[model samples]
Target: MAGARVTTGSRLGVRIREVPVPADLDAPDAWLLRGQVDTVNEVEIALRGNRDMCRNPHETLGSMREQRYTTKIRLVAVDEDRPGDAADPARVLGHAALHLPRQDNTHTGEVDLGVRPAARRRGIGSALHDAALEVARVHGRTMLTTTTQQTSEPTDGPLALAPSTGSGRLHRDDPGVRFALTRGWSLEQVSRYSVLDVPLPADVLAAHRAAAQAVAGPDVRVVLWESRCPDEWVDQFALLQTRMSTDVPHGGIARHADVWDAARVRTIEQQFLDQGLGYLVAAAEHVPTRTLVAFTALAATPVTDEFVFQNDTLVMREHRGRRLGMLVKTANLQRLAAERPAVQRVGTWNAEENAHMLAINVALGFRPAGGTGEWQRDL
Candidate 1:
């Protein structure tokens, strides 16, 4: 059970305490706990002006509760009779996940907050975030993390169009980045967003398809995903994710690799479905003498009628060449266009020097979206 203690701050009288483990999670607490993304959306909106830029981030069911259970998450209740009754009971004023030992620490707990907009200027966020810090401190974690985008970048800024949950303006950075600054979190990393516009010429697409098909031979297969997921694909998807952990240029992630599990992958999928994900493909090619050689995917998100996000695309190491990457990209585009015909552009990112990925992206029409350093602090 949560060990309640008296604490005073902001306009609300509140009992800040540790949230109990799974056993004591009541229905309301459980429900509220499950609403992390909602809290996140509100928190993000309150900080950044745009509210429709973070949709479809994960693809798992009941992902929020599962994450809280897994991450050492906490919930702080504002006592109605206490000093901050002006704050809404339902608002998750602060939230911080443990910065358990991992590959990186520049951004960890204190990175994201979920406070209600109306509760701003009150000490709720600080208290909640500070409470998050307590969770990290007890665990021996040193870094408190957070970030907000730069508002003045450009209409064609690096980020691909992402959907935020509430009705808000677009292209505005949240003030939460300020929260990180005040709390001592510094700019640790920045990645550019790149895109491919002006569709590939019909001749070019046709030639690329033919080349990929010829390279793979008759047994090699590339399958396009429809709206609903199929049963046979789940395990395959998980296997592909294992490869992703090491492949991405995430040199500063704070969570340890051992912490990853099938549940995490499932949650990402659940979050994606909740946010309206679009287009996917799984590729496998039968090499000569019956060897199966390649696999990859091209996934994207629609920003507006004219823009789509080519989020993260990956090709298995052993199957790097042989056109499997191209096959998946072509397939994703074909499927995306068919399902959402009006999308006219696509964007993506890759480490500045990753030649292979850059080659593939360039071939398909992606251009540089700037680059940000992936700096981190040893917390």
Candidate 2:
């Protein structure tokens, strides 16, 4: 993970240096981690306001560390500073991260950047973006991508307009989106982040389950598991994961189906277990073929049971149009409520153009909380 340093002296006198490890949650490194987290938090709050969409990563740092992913963090500072420099306090004006995949999807690299609210237009973000781009190039990545929360009408009419003078006021009007567009990045897709307030009426849950059961017919059975997938069904789960990439609507983003095997599935399952995270998996199995046709999962951290993230939900192409998607999602939500009673809300993301999946989510009482734009540049 060694690379030449990327530094830029400009509008506000800032430098970008790589942060190799951002795992330590206490003391010295904790301060550095806070600087990085605070800047991103400030930006999110400014854009999303009091919405539940704003993310606070102060406690999730350790859990994010995974052996299978390569992530480099770069801090934009005022003084002559580097990672782990004990002499001077790092005046982190902004920060950026370059994420590269180790196991698969090696051709694409992700760039995450943020600037403090007080230091918005001083070229700090530019420096960090340039540094991340160079690092991606050095790592032999051809595609650079990022996602941003934007405040605008989530409609095709406004989205179709290119970045130009006097355009509507969107979060895109911010420095981050302008910087990406000026640097040759294209808007690939738009996605909506939906939130579902939990503990719906008893009747609602019973009705959803009844509807799913009726749609599933007698041939399809619902299955639930916690944490790890059973050994016998590992291959079936991997196949479904591989199909998710192509089956899900990605809009214009160029992404190949992920290469997943039994080993990869096990690796991920173990990761969640090690992090003390609770997982709920619900799948719809076709009794006649004795195969899993649809599946959904929810990830909840034991440290805080206030919220759970909807991981993934997929139904095989041949098995669609039978309400399996809703069935699996509802079944998993029921399992989460029963097993992890502390969860108050669940969050999920879907491409704006994915009407089918969106319809299912709306049916289950999920509402749009915010929107995200997927930006990309091909090198």
Best by TM-score: 2
> How does each model score on lDDT?
0.51, 0.72
Summed over model 1, clashes come to: 37
TM-score of 2: 0.85
Candidate 1 per-residue lDDT over residues 1-379, each given as its tens digit: 2535434553665455443333223433343343343555665465445443333223212233344223545555444463443433353444443434332332344434455666566666777666666666666666654444433233544432222211111232435544555665545444554667646676787777778778856767765564334555555555665656565555343543333445555665665555455546555635343432344444444333456666556666766666777776776666665666666667665553456667777777776644333323345
Off by over 4 Å in 1: 1-39, 43-61, 67-69, 72-111, 114-125, 137-148, 151-188, 194-220, 226-237, 252-279, 289-311, 321-323, 340-349, 352-379
List the lowest-lDDT window of 10 residues for candidate 1.
Answer: 161-170
**141 in model 2: Cα distance from truth in Å?**
0.7
Q: Pairing residues by index, what is the TM-score of model 1?
A: 0.60
TM-scores for every candidate against the unseen true structure: 0.60, 0.85
